[model samples]
Target chain A: MKFVDIITTAIANSFRSKLRTGLTVIAIFIGAFTLTITSGIGTGVTSYINSQVSAIGAADVLTVSKAGDATATADDGPAPYDPDKATAISLGNGSRPGSTIQALTDADLGTIEATSGIVGVDPAVQVTPDYIEYDDSGKFELTVNAAATLTTADLAAGEQLDNESTTDQILLPTTYLDTLGFSTPESAIGETVTIGIADFAGTQQQVPATVVGVQNETILGAGAGLNQPLTDRLHAVELSGTPAGAPQSYATATARFDLDASDAEITAIKADLADQGYAAQTVADQIGSFETVINVIIGVLNAFAVIALIAAGFGIINTLLMSVQERTREIGLMKAMGMNGGRVYALFSTEAVFIGFLGSALGALVAVGVGSLVSNILATTVFENLPGLQVVQFAPSSIAIIIGVVMLIAFLAGTLPARAAARQNPIDALRYE
Target chain B: MTVPVLSAQNIGKSYGSGANRFDALKGVSVDIRAGESIAIVGKSGSGKSTLMHLLALLDDPDSGALLVEGTDAKKLKGKEVNRLRNQDFGFVFQQFFLTANASVLDNVVLPLKIAGVGPKERRARGMKALEQLELADKAKNKAMNLSGGQKQRAVIARALVNNPKVIFADEPTGNLDTTTGAVVEDILFSLNRDKGITLIIVTHDIDLAARCDRQIFIRDGLEDVTRSPEAIEKPAGAHA
Candidate 1:
């Protein structure tokens, strides 16, 4: 018999029993759709993490942090700083000095740049203080830690802070404008801000500064008020007439290098930092705790999606079994008409696969819409607490994987039923009432 | 020397096993020649249907040899049996086993489709068969919508679609009224006369059996070929 005739007949027979066919299609659709959406979300989360990691620069970045001394580890809790050691090392007022504290310095940065396979290195200085206030309204004070001066090229908008300026000027992050309820970045520029610096005696003294420009904020770091709104944290104070006896607080000197830098070069940089008696840690080590939390969230979501997909598979089995029962005589007739077992199996499997394909397509579309809506809603409400973080992104690989999985599941679900139909004895089937 | 269209030897069939086993056919043998119309008259449970099934290759008989058009029926398997049934024998059941969902034309083309004829050829042969049965006008009508006599004619057209050498009618007119049965009987006889196709019919209708060229009486799975005076006298009285 012609293959066209068999296919056409199968399709026609399926249609002849419209309710059954519709229900079967729906079962497959639900399965495929669930897979598509879940996979889409998974893809979105992974891609979001990757982009954040990429912004930090390089996939192979491995960070190391200092391990505490025996006594501190035994204590396993926060400890008071050693004032005598802090004064000896000139590490602010009451900072503790430990054997593993390896600070990075300019010399260490230079050594890293000169190492084999090393590229450009950027050395940085960091300070932590609560020195942010607004002249317009004295209602709130912004408390922050860590500060850095970045070039205008790194900013999503506005000009960079001038290194040679005698005046106390600074650039704010875009997220700061959002926090201050300013409608746009331009409006936040040139704003006067009075920063309160805590002296050694723990008294607040005010320093006036002007906002020179505004920079865009990154999503991952936006919520924590870290890099964004740096104007308050990184105060551009007049240093020409400053007292020489002023204490150097807890400071960070960071180095940026090309992604292709070898592990040997990185190790050399670390060793050089240790030789300089400065403590250093990589960015990955600092964010390790955060990544673990994000991974757990992704895993939980995937598990739920997998359960739904399994349920959908059961639905397929039920629908296909029903179809087999209804088409018993038709199948027998086909067998009698010389349709081989393989051909019959292929026909039923094809129907199942087609159902899955359509369902997955529909599901992916729904996931995209849902992801966008949920992301936007969360950004406006729950995510409002965080300043510049993006939680979701459109991911194509995830969608493709979802489609592939749905097709595979649907094909597999149809196999047993199709085989059962094929294995039926033609004589018994013909005799079946 | 006319060729024997069908030959069966020592055909026996039984149901169940051991003590409960009951033989339906006990070593029955028969030969049917080309263009010969033979009626096998039997009471119920006489094994006539079993013999038809065996001859049609729809079922295999135990400890027997059966041949149709010189090909051994015992040797054929699976699709080969289907091919033999399609290419050599046409079967008409008392129930008129036309696909109720299909139109008359589709019903006729069913056997040709089974034989793997191309669509155009299948349709052409189907239409020709319908024309032969004078059911061409009802070609597009569903078999379910037809009268009992019309349905039988449609089934006959389906049976003849592949141009088989022999046609088997197992009480083809059993479900019809006397007037409709007469019409069906006339069509069957005309096919045998005009197409020279051998016909074998199993029936309990004495009037129907009288129309055939030859009749064999079956009782308790055994054939009595001896012409009884009563059987000869009945046909003569019907003619008078």
Candidate 2:
């Protein structure tokens, strides 16, 4: 028979027993729906985290520090502290508690910069500012870190930090706008703010900087950011009263390599750093741990969805088997009319594929609708503090892939029954009661 | 002098294997010409149906050659055989195996559909066949809704739709009443007479067999030469 005719006939035959076909479709629907939803969740969370990480614009940068020796337990009477390793730096957020490596000094920064793959190194300068005061507001305690040269902060208003500019510049967080006596982020731009810092001898000094920008809050970035000039000015003022013998060291530092380097190349660079008694972590490595956990959860969910699909596949087999049984005489008649065995198999298999198409298309379409609705509702309620998060998101390609996979499963499930129908002896089938 | 449309030469077919094997058609041979109505008449299990199936190319013979249009069927590939059957033959069974949920027209156009005829032409040809059977008005009705006689007429329409060189009827009127059976028998003979289509009917009724131009008696899986066409004709009314 013509392929078109076989398809139409198979579609018609599938609906002959509507209840059975409908039940089978419902089973497949459950699988497709769950699969789509879980895949959407994976896409949603990953994209959100990716957006946050990209906004920080530190993809190629790696934080490097002197690798600390594995410390002794509390019962070991605390290993003798070396004065050279006085400072400890915490790797934030995803790292385990007390996962502190030793500080990076000027010598360590020079060593990192001298490494073959390292293009630049920025030592994390410790700037302790006592307070930041505006025109009329009282002084407020401040936490400040110099903005990395490579980072393009997620800004609320004004331009980025001008690291090359001679004048000191500061980028305030959005939370400081009202407290800094500015009605809006834009109004704070180009205005001067005083940062008070205490020297090592307890003498207080004030440094002035122009507010160049206001940045939005992000999970990875905390406190205000200072440009190079501002950090240099603050460091110079605080050092004026420092005791001559006081040792100086940086808590942490960032090392930059070629952005387009391959993963193996990047690993080699890290190994090189490790050989120099330093440990390095790329930005992806820092955020990747969280993503890994999320992926494991999503992978588990996907496994359940696959199990459901396998069950649905069995339902398709059962449905087609019964259909073949009920239509034995019709099959015999068709065969007698010169419809070949291949055509007979195509007829039955097309019915199965059609069923799969209906269930998956409906399931994916409904999932997109329902998932979007739930995402919108959750975004407004549960995830209100997270501005750019969508709890469930769909990619068109992923949806198409899901439907295709389900259809493949259905076609495989159908082969058993289709082969049975095709292999039937026409004369015996005609005589079938 | 014309080549017979179908010629079976000592074709043998058996069922089962080893000790349980039973010969359904043992060295049965026959030739059917175009435009002739021939009957293979026998009682149940007399191998009449087996002979029809082999002649129709629905099953392969265990031995010997079955020829269609003088070409040895054994030499043809499975696909070629299917094409030959689809294009050159039609079938009607007593069971009236119309798809119950499908329209009568759908059932009639099945052969044309199998032959990959386009929808419009298939419909036109199907309607013409149904008109010949006087079932044009019932074309849209589902097969299950048709009466017994109407169903058999629909089956006849299906057989005629393909415009085959030969029609194989397996007890075509066995399920119909005498009045309807006679109507169906008249249609089959008329097609043979007017269209020059070969007719091969398998039946047990001597009265039905007598209506054919010739009769072949099958007994014990082989042709029964003792009961000739003259004997079959003479006893046509006695069996009724």
Candidate 3:
């Protein structure tokens, strides 16, 4: 028989027993549905982590901090250091490292810059920008949330703050336009705004800077950009007038290396720096643990989904065997009419594949719909504290892979029954009651 | 004489071995000519149906040579055998083996489809054969919906759809009443007479045997023609 005719006949015969085939399809649906959702969770979380890590800085830049004598747990935020008393520094994420880390002396700075492969070094000083005003507006408290030099940020208006420019320039976030009485990001361009922060002696100090651009923030993280001039101004005011804290030191140190350096050379430089009692990390190193944790969770979830798919494969075997038994006489009649054994085998196998397709396509489509809806709701509720976090994500390639896997399982399940149908003796089948 | 359309010589087959052993056909042989209507009448378990199956190439004999249109059928390849069964032979069984779920048109189209005929031509030939059997109008009806005579006619249409050279009916009317059986027999005989198609019937009914041009009898797995002196005088070694 022609392949087309075999396919048509197989399709016609699948409906010969609808209820049994439907039950088998349902089993596969449960498996595919669970698999798609679990993969979505993996995609969504890891994608969010990627955005967070990117927000930290470019690949060639590392945050360096002083390593301390005392061992610190992984959760230790940052080591507190006092210049007057001796203290060891184990600087980590967002921290600068050294023992009793004092202000980086000119001598220390020269030594850091002289390190091989060290192209540049910028000291980071954390300062709280407490209050702000535009022109003659009333003073409104604001948070200068993680203002840093961003390598990649989508802009709403104007150009990026030039990091090489000596002018004190800050980039305004998209949300601040309405709050600061600016009708639009375009209107806020090149406008001067005053920022208030506490001086070293605990006095309210107001500093003015120009807004060079406006930035679009994502759901996970957003930040303002500050060039060297602006960051230096904030640090100077923060250190002046004898603030309550005893001495001066940097919160973190940003180091630049050749972006084209090989991974091995970069690793060597980091090891040398670590030997100097300093911890150094690229953005990926900071977030590598996050990737591991999410992947493990996704792996466990997928195990359950695989188990469901295995169960569904058994259902396929049971369904096809019953179909073969019920069609015994019909099979005999077809063979007598000159249908070959191979064609008979193909006919049954096609039925199995068709069932697999029905279940997987339906399950994947429904999973996308349901998973997206749930993730959207969580975006506003459960994940309200974290911006740009998609709890569940779906990819087209993942969907294709899921369907392919399910079909493979179904094909394997059908083999035994299809062979049995092909090998049936026509005379005996005809005589079967 | 023209070469017999089908010839089986000294055909033999056995069942289970050891104490349960039994010969189904021991040296059974027959030659059937084109357009000839013949019968192998016998009591139950007398090897009548076994010989028919061997002749139809549905089963292989333990030891024998079978020929079709003078070709040594035993030497034909598997594909060639299937092609001959699809194109040159048709069968009608006592139970009228039509798929109960399929429509009459679909049932009749089965043989031609298996022969690899295209859909349009299979349907056209299937419809024409049903019309000849006076069952064309009921083509869309289910097989189980037809009465005994109508069901037999549908089965006949299915067998004829491929325009086979020979029709083998094994107790074709066994399950029907006398009047229905007579109608079925008339259709089979007319097909042989008008189309010049060979007819081979296997039955226990002497009256049905009387309608054929010649009848062969089988007793204890061997040929016996006590009722036909002409058959007894025929040369089994004519080709050999």
Candidate 4:
């Protein structure tokens, strides 16, 4: 008969057995719902990671470090460098004088800035030293501090150090300022501080410096506990002039470049730095350990989601097969009247798909509600101290994929049952008790 | 003068193979004309139902040529036989065989649905068929809700929905009371008389067989035309 008549008849017949029909629909619904929730979670995680990566200029920044040396090497190789060992060497307690393989020099930064795709370059220099600071109570306390130079571009507020100036002016990150009882960035600026500097010869010199700027510290540094906001542990200090002593121990040189460089262009820049006896790494390589951890977490979550979806599919099949058995006689009557095997198959399949659609729609609604509730609970309970962990959001692509997957599962569930119904012999079916 | 609505020649049907084979029909030949009501009357296990099935094209017979309205049934494939059943033959079973879950209208329109008619036309034809059976008022009521008599009438309406040339009733009134059986018989005869349709009924009811224009008697898998008088005679004190 006409498609409309066949579909209407099939739907009408299904409802004739309300409990069976409802169960089948529920099966499809579960399948669709699980798929939507899992995919939505995946989308949320991906989006969150992407945003965090963007905040760190992950898409544009690349890092280069010394590869293989007891301490620092110019070559880009794998070596676990320990700052404690460098400190021991500086204290002359180690037999092997730490090697001074400068990875990136001013010349390397200049060369990188001159590269065709390169827009700007800044050399980063860092050294961590133990400083005894007298607090307001006049008690001398040994505090571990990282002395580094950061550019104006990297600073979230205030200004960078003057490249040609001999003045002892430096920028303090907000974390360090917070620990020092400074309420705001403006208050932290112009605060004079004294640091004890020691040379490899074991001679110490006291230097007075004024905070010319304040900046918000990067999450990487914060998460590493290097810049404890409550402890005011790390400080960014600019060297006024070169010290007359043996070569410095544990130096870090960082360079910033243009954002739009392609992979090939980045590789060329790395090669030029290597030619100058320097090691190079991309931003992704710098965060390789973090990325691995994130991937493992996402992969495990997705696997669980897949298992749930499979279970849902089984549920659908069971429901649909039961439905076919219950409606066997009705199917036979339709076939006898003029409904070809194909029409009968389509009718059953269409019902299955509709069930799937309904289930998925319900699932999506449930996911949104559950996701919102979970996110709110997480934000209020576990993530209260953390910023930017409000609600999990999914992309439109995720929505489409979830719906498509649910529909596919539903179709598969209905297919075999429909075929069984279609293959039934009319005479045998009519004779069925 | 016109072609016979159904003709069967030397039709033989057997179950199983080789030893222990049981033959349901033995080279029986019959022709049923248009506008005539005929009955095949026999006791249980006789070949009457088998002959009716062969006439309705619901089953194939070995070593026989059967034709309906000049179309060779023997040459038709499985699908073609089903098409013939759809377009040329209507069947009424003893158990009513109405789709119990569906409404009377849906049960009647079942044949038209199988024919792939559009909804509007299927409904109109189903309604017309129900009207003819005086079941129009019960159109929306489920078949199971109908009385034994009304259920049979609904089944008859379903059979007539396709307007087939031949109506095959295999013990159509077997499950009904005597009053309902007589009413069903009247409806069948009226259909044959008014619409010029062929009616072939298989029953053990001799009175029912006697009401038809002609009666065929089947005994031990063979037609016994000499026993036609016995087919006509009702049992002593038997209720009609």
The candidate that achieves the highest DockQ relative to the unseen native structure:
2
Question: What digit string (tens of lDDT, one per residue) describes model 3 on residues B82-188?
Answer: 88888888989888888888899999999987877899999899999999999999999999999989999999999999899999998998999999999999999
Candidate 1 per-residue C-alpha lDDT over A1-433 given as tens digits, one digit per residue, 9 for 90 to 100 = 5667656655555565567667666665565555555555555555555544444533343332222233556557855785433332233323455422433344445555564433455433333445466645443445332232322223544555654566666566655665555677777667777666554445556666677766555444331123333333343322223467654322343445456666666666667655544444556554565567766776787677677667777666777788788768767655654456777787777666666676677777776777678878877898775433445556787778877887788789889888998887654565577
Clashing pairs in 2: none
- Using Cα atoms with residue i matched to residue i, what is each candidate's TM-score against the true structure? 0.72, 0.91, 0.85, 0.75
Q: Model 4: which docking level applies?
A: acceptable
Per-residue lDDT tens digits for candidate 4, residues A186-248, read 876666665565544445555555666665443333310122221221222323344755234
Among all candidates shown, the one with the greatest TM-score? 2
DockQ (model 1, Cα): 0.30
Evaluation by lDDT, superior candidate among 1 and 4:
4
> At residue B144, what lDDT does model 1 achieve?
89
Output DockQ, candidate 3: 0.58
lDDT of 4 at A260: 71
DockQ score of the complex predicted as candidate 4? 0.41
- In order, the TM-score of chain B in each prediction is 0.91, 0.97, 0.93, 0.93
Model 4, residue pairs in steric clash: A1-B116, A29-A359, A67-A77, A124-A254, A337-B114, A338-B114, A338-B115, A339-B114
Comparing 2 with 4 on TM-score, the higher-scoring candidate is 2
lDDT of 2 by residue, A29-106 (tens): 999999999999999999988776665566678888787665567677878867665577665433588786666767
TM-score of chain A of each: 0.67, 0.88, 0.82, 0.66
Over 4 Å off in model 2, which ranges?
A55-60, A71-84, A87-99, A110-120, A126-135, A138-150, A175-185, A193-197, A201-208, A235-240, A257-265, A287-290, B236-239
Which order, best to worst by lDDT? 2, 3, 4, 1
Please state what fraction of the native interface contacts candidate 3 reproduces: 0.54
lDDT score, candidate 3, position A104: 46
Candidate 2 chain A, run of 10 with poorest lDDT: A143-152
